[model samples]
Target: MDVAEYTPQELARLQLGFIIREQPQQNADHSGTHASSRKRELQRGQQKARQEMLDDLGVEA
Candidate 1:
């Protein structure tokens, strides 16, 4: 086995992530819990980003 087989791009992918449709379907119930959680996370991130922009503009959150 060679320790020098890794490249920067390959290492980045190892730290990266992606959604698998099958796994969520198999694991989560039919209530779409995983999706709702992801959506909530996304919304929170967006809200935080928007708040940052508003703060920069001296606007109220």
Candidate 2:
């Protein structure tokens, strides 16, 4: 899947637990799942939602 087609929320949602630990290959570094651990959990939920949406479209996360 094209990463550029993903929404900001979808992209941000993917970088949950390993924020600074995971570096973007080509894009600029993004500060996602920051602030607190709960934020990461929330992002996980968002990721789940996005995944479900993709699944409905016959795409797997």
Candidate 3:
């Protein structure tokens, strides 16, 4: 748990691999309509962001 022990590259690798997901309770829509849409949207956003980061790092995904 001591991040200080990790080098910058190691820390960045860990950070980039971490994903924060939204809880079902976070969305008031229990009907599975808006929530699914939002989830897909968020996933696409994450994928785009990750691709951008990988591109910047010159790493192939």
Give the lDDT ranking, best first: 3, 2, 1
lDDT of 3: 0.65
Which scores better on TM-score, 1 or 3? 3
lDDT tens digits by residue: candidate 2, 1-61: 9999988766765664355344343124544454445455556676677777798789856
lDDT of 1: 0.55
Candidate 3 has a TM-score of: 0.55
Q: List the candidate 1 regions with Cα displacement exceeding 4 Å.
A: 1-31
Q: How many residue pairs clash in each candidate?
A: 0, 0, 0
Please rank every candidate by TM-score, starting with the best. 3, 1, 2
Clashes in model 2: which pairs?
A: none
Which portions of model 3 miss their true places by more than 4 Å?
1-20, 27-29
> 1-61, model 1: which lDDT tens digit per residue?
4546866544433333223223356445655777777756655655665576588789986
Q: In model 3, what are the clashing residue pairs, if there are any? A: none
Per the 3 Å backbone cut-off, how many clashing residue pairs does candidate 1 have?
0
